[model samples]
Structure formats: C-alpha cells, structure tokens
Target: MTTTHQERPLAVLVGVQLPGVDDVEHAADLAELGRLVQTLGFDVIATVSQRRGALAAAAVLGEGKLKELAELTGGSGVVPSGAPERKNKARARRAAESGEDDEDDALGGDDDEGDADGAGSRGARRATVVAVDHDISPSQARNLERATGAQVLDRAGVIIEIFHRHARSREAKLEVEIARLNYVAPRLRETGGGGDRQRGGIGGKGAGESALELDRRKIRDRIAELKQELAAIQREQSTRRALRQGQRRVALVGYTNAGKSSLMRALTGSEVLVADKLFATLDTTVRALHPEVRPRILISDTVGFIKKLPHDLVASFRSTLDEALEASLLLYVADASDPTFRDQLGVTRSVLSEIGASEVPSRLLLNKVDRLSEDERDALRLEFPEATLLSAKIPADVAALRESLIAHFEASMVEAELLLPYAKQSLIGEIYENARVLSEEYGDDGGRLAVRAHPAALDRLRSLLAR
Candidate 1:
C-alpha cells in the first residue's frame, strides 16, 4: 500500500524563510513548490526548512541543516571542494551521449545516487531530486548537488520544466524552448576529461574553448534561432488578433489551477484541456462565448501566472499574454476555497502589471465557491464586496457569469441604423454577426435595421456599407 522511490522519482523540498517573509507565506511557498514537484511526477518525501537573514551563498542552508538534509538522501553530509569536477564532467558527457541533456532528465540516472565514494551502504532511502523553494545561483545548485547527492532544481527550474512538458501549440513550444535554453545556458558544465579540449584555433596551437563554453555557445545560437521562429509565429498570431479587433474579447487571467480552465469550459463550451495540475494549459485558446450572444464575445484562456514566474518565461510568453492586454475585459479568476487565494490574486495582479495589462478593465471572479462553507462564503463576500463569487460547476452560476460578461460589453454599445440595399442582401449575415439587431423593416429598395454594437464595430460596418 506504499510507493517506493523506484516507482516514482522521490523529491525533497527545501525552503529558507528569509527576512520580511512571515511563516504563512513561507509555508505557502513550500506547499506550492511541492505541487510543482508533483507536477513533474516526483513524490515529495520530506521538506527541509530554515530561518535565516539570507540564503547561504554556498549551500543555501546552514551547515547543520545541510548535513541533516543529506542524511535523507544518502549523501556524505559534507560539502566538498571542487574535487567532484571530474566526476561531474563524466556524468555530463554520459548524459550528453545519451541525448538526455536536451530532455527533462535532470533527475534521471539512478547511478548518480548514493554517496560520493560509490558506497551504497547509506541505508536511508535516497531522494532523487532536491527542489528548492527559491531561485539559487548556478554555483549554489552545484554545491547542493554535491552535498546532497541528488539533482537540484530551484523554483524557476521546476516551473520551466512544467511549461516545457505542458506546451502544446507551436508558439508555446518555441517560447518554452527559448526559456529552457536560457535556463540551461548558464548551468552548462565542462564535460569529458578535465583537460580535454575542443579545437577553436585555426592552427590548433592555441587552447581551444572548453566543452562548457561550446555548449553555452550552442545554446545561445539555438535560442536565437528559436526566437526567430517564435517571431514568425507571433507575426501570424498578430494578424489573427488584428482581425478580431472589432469583436468583443474577454480574457480569463488568473493563477494556475484556480479553476480558470473549468470556468472557461463552462462559459465557452470549448473542450480545452482541463486538469488539476500546475501549468496545465499553456496555449492561448480563443473560444466564442457559448449560447453565442449577438456581437459574439470571444473568450480567451491565457496561460496562468504564478508567484516568482521566471522573467525569461514572462518575456517569452508576452505574445501569449497579449490576450489579456488587448481584451475588452479581463476576468481575474481565483479559487475562493483556497486559504492562499488572496496571495495568489496579488501575484496575478503583479504579473499583469509587469506585462502592462493592469490598465485593462477587469472583474474579480472568486470561483469554486461550492467548496466553501456558508460562513466562509460570507467572509469572502465581505472581503471582496465587488467580486463575483460562484462555482464553475453550477449551471446557474455559469449562466450568471455569461450574462454578466454580455452585460459588461453591452454597456458600451451604441445604437445604430443600417440600411441594407436589396443588391447587397448578402450583408445581412454580417450585420447579425457584428451586432444585436433590435428591429428590421424590409422595403423595395433596401432593408432598414436598428442594432447595438461597439463603436469600432459600427465604424467597420459603415465602411463596409460604403464600399
């Protein structure tokens, strides 16, 4: 009835409570890190936490705590000097040879477990990975790997891995690749023998570049190529977005696993990928609001944001986040049942601000209220008086949300009269598609119609009528 490390990769979570971070925030961050590790298929076995003014530059944890952490991973409980460079180089070369370097095999290779002396006698069950709650330096990661005898992944690494795995669209895949390459470029190490050199000089007399330098250069070149490809894809996306400029667009932006996808499915009736994992949906999916209201509202589900989302990913996914930036309205969704939903909402706002989406008109939607008790719901209502509290599962709640979306856009609509000529009767579909027809009267020469639509859409309709 129990799972072993062999069945699933075992991970040990590590956290350091720094200055200005209270216990609640620290605990929440560590819990989020555990979810991220689980998202990568790792079963977190234990957590090592420490309170310090700052994270230790060398090992991230104090000496005693470091050793304590090592015991759980069958390590030697000592941070050695740079003597393991040769062994690490060999491991890197083997990983490269097996094509594992380009994959999400950071915690692979069972041979790398156990103590540094190749002694498997440390009876404690070893963890295959150590996931840090905060971002650490490359050197710090290497030192921790040496001290704990496990693959080390900081918070950013875990998030990037999840994005890499969940990316489905070409644009998302390219963006994830760029972010992954940027992450790996700095962590490249010299492989092969310690003194082995690759030829970089014309005559071969001068010392050539190290394997590490070559790898870094390759990563840089690959990242550049990926960016160019991503740019091309983004150009196509821009064109498509431009076409939707006259239509009403409502974007769903929120923290990961905040039930955005569930609400998205309910409101739009689109079969988008819905899951209970971090970064489950990375692709930007645009679906028309179901029951399909006049002046159809295009609802977009963008990639969810998280606390400490990597800057590289933010920059790479800017095109994707443009869905939020350009929306006529934004729905800031959150799980009201979660105790940390407030913090999660703050993070979502911070990221939106970083992407310049803060100026967009938005509504707070506290989802999953079905899980909350009556007292909890009342407390939430008092705290967020203006927010819409509803669960995605309830049909009436979904209908209310859908109507609210329609009403929000309808508030800005202007009434207009269009005369559809008999010769251009085919244009009737266009009018019905772009506006809510209030009335229509057909005559011998043309049909007189009254409609309500956004100003931009009406202008477009007038231009089409003129042509």
Candidate 2:
C-alpha cells in the first residue's frame, strides 16, 4: 500500500489587545495560541500582535496590520511561480485587504520568505496559515483570508481543530463532530460562479438553493444525527452511573494540562494518559481511589477547560461534564507554577456554574507545587490559605489528598445498628453493597449489624428493613 505523509504548515500567530485588556494576559493568550497551533502539528513562524481601541468591522485587524500579514503570506508583492494566476491576483489582494483567503495551504508550496522576522525577507518561506488568537466573525475571517492570501483560523476554529484531533472515544468523537459541524455550518461559503444554480420556474418551489446551502443543510442533518447518537450514549452513561449511585464520587476538574491526570494516577494507581499537551485527555476516565475504602470512592478525570472555549464545544460536552454534577466533591486542580492559574481557576468556575455544578462542594488543589519555588509556594499559601497545595507526582501529597477525600466522605456518613431478620436476609446483601459494615452478629432468627454510610444509604436500607 502506498503511504501519504502530511507536512507541517508554517503559521503566523495573531492577537489583538482591546481597550481595558491587560498586556500580560493578551501576551499569554497569544503564547497559548502558539501552543495550540503546535498541538495541531503546525510550526509557528511568527506572531502578529496589536493594541486597538476597537476591532475593525470588516477585518479584525487594522489596515497597516493587514498589510503586514499580507507581506508575510504573499511574499515581496510578487506572486511566486505556481502561485495563483495574474487574473486572480486582484481578488487575492482584496481578500487579503479584508483579512480573508480563498482556501487553506495546509500542505502548500515552498516559501520565498523564510526570514526569522516573517518580513518576507529574501529566500524566506511565506507563512502558510494565519492563526488568530481571538474569535473573529465569519465575515472578518473571510476578509482576513482574502487580504493575507492564506488560511485564516480564529481562536475558536483552532480550538475546535485541536478537539477534533484529540477526541478518541465514540462519545468524544461524536461530541467533537457535532461541535465542529455547528461551527462550520455557518462559515460555509460558495466559491466561484457555481453558486448561481437554479431549478424550476417557480418563485419558491424550485430547488434554487446553491451548493453552499445544500452543504449547510447536510451539515445540519449530520449534526442532528450526531446529537441523537450522543443522546443514546449519554443514556448508557447514565445507566452506568446509576449502578454506582451509592458510592461517593470525586471529580478532578481544572484547566488544561493542570496535572489532573497525574493526580488521578497518583491517587487511583490507574495509568491515565498524561501528557504536557493541552487537552491530551479528551475522554473521561474513571477509576477507584487507591487505599480503597468501603463503598469504594470513584474518581473521574474529565476534559479540562480553557480560556474562550467554543460555546458549541461546551454545549456538546455537557453530558460528559455532568460527571461534575454527579460528583459529591470536585477537586479544582491548578498548576501552581503558572502565574495565570488564578484566571484558569476562574474559567473552570464559570464553566462549572454554566453546567449547574456550582452547588457541588469543591476544594481548590494548587498542584505541581514541586515546580514552584519556596517563595512562590509561600505566596500562594498566603494568597489562598484554605487551598490545598501539593504535587501529584509525590506519593505523600497524593496520600494526603486521598485522605482529605476520605475525610469528606466520612464526615457525611451516619452510624446505625440494625437487627436484620432472617426472613429479610436479602436486604443484608444490599447493606453490604452500599455501606461500611463495621460489625456483624449472628443469632437464631436474624443477624445484627453496625454500619456507617451516607444518610441516604441508611434511609434506603431502613426502608427495606421496615418493609
């Protein structure tokens, strides 16, 4: 069989700082965008950033910035050999001026602008893609693409692309596709004159829709089908969750690449996929917490949150994030070494609230403490005295976190002694299954047992006892 190799495209990262935005945060966003592009197998060639009072309506960037972007892509105002024809140059220039391009160059030709500064210097390869660090309207995206003569991917587009690549499980794949279709359906455009197709001679009775409209309709149909499939998957998930209803559940939640999977492995001894890449773990993994207590504690690590996560993605993952809703406790893990961890925490909180998990009891986990200096650790401790500071890689820290989880569960448990009858012996199995049976006694007609379990479990057992 013949094999095909994909080439990594060179990308130019772009960001704009609006009025009242902090310079540091904007820069961090751009840096994160670069990382995102790298995750998608792109080589970041340069970054374009600007500060503006307001974004331009047509192109997200100003006129001067658009020219800079065009120079990076078009190369010294001269079309390279094998580039688009002279007749199309005006259209490309107009698109570039408006910050749009005709099609992507994911594996396009060699560049003549490989200069380090991306200034289209001699012999330098032109950037193949422009990755914008902020969400741009569809019109603006088109305009930027036209002006730059390169593919223009705004922040949401980049994120959705990453999700598409990272999704592995069936549910995850379905969710990603649904989100992607929703995002792309509106951005679909008809290229050239083929969009002028018509049908029967009636005003509205004809199939007068263009190929673009047909494509959008197909996308809509596919999204609906995916949603139905996802709903069925979610129902199966709900059934599985129902099976573990009585057990205490703790969900590990936080920003992307925040050591959650590491902590899950440390606490549960399960080989959860751990990588430095953002969104490395898209599928939720559930495992039993180690040093397993009676009525085992189940820990789940979910897809992490990020700044400006696409709304469609969040809506699509609502079923997955429902784990947080079912959780008895939520461990909000964060990278202690990251200066922007606070903002990351805020993003997680906002998402949780949106998903109706705000009422769930949660604890802040300032993880990766090993990466922080003594002063930084102390400063964090002072800043949030109630937050738990620990490194997931350390056994002791994991043990401490485990114990804290156990304590929380134990505190919610109620103690009770019940004299179970032999005739009702079947109830004994349920009590054993749902509670911590501390003591048992056997008598002629029955057995007496002392158990500690959540009040709900006790009430459930008591109902069976009375019946």
Candidate 1 — which pairs collide? none
List per-prediction Cα lDDT, in the order shown.
0.85, 0.82
Measured on C-alpha atoms, candidate 2 has an lDDT of 0.82
Lowest-scoring 10 consecutive residues by lDDT in candidate 2? 104-113
Model 1 Cα lDDT, one tens digit per residue, 1-467: 99765567678888887668887888889889999999999887777777655666677876767776787787776778753322335544765776652212212123223322232243444788999998898988989998989999999999999999988989999999999999988887766574467656763423676666666777887998999999999999999998888899999999999999999899988898899999999999999999888989999999998999999999999999999999989999999888999989999999999889999999999999999999999998899999999999999999998888888898899998998988888888888888999999998879999999999999988888889
Candidate 2 lDDT for residue 405: 89
Q: For model 2, what is the error of residue 385's alpha carbon versus the real structure, in angstroms, after optimal superposition?
A: 0.6
* Clash number for each model: 0, 23
TM per candidate comes to 0.87, 0.86
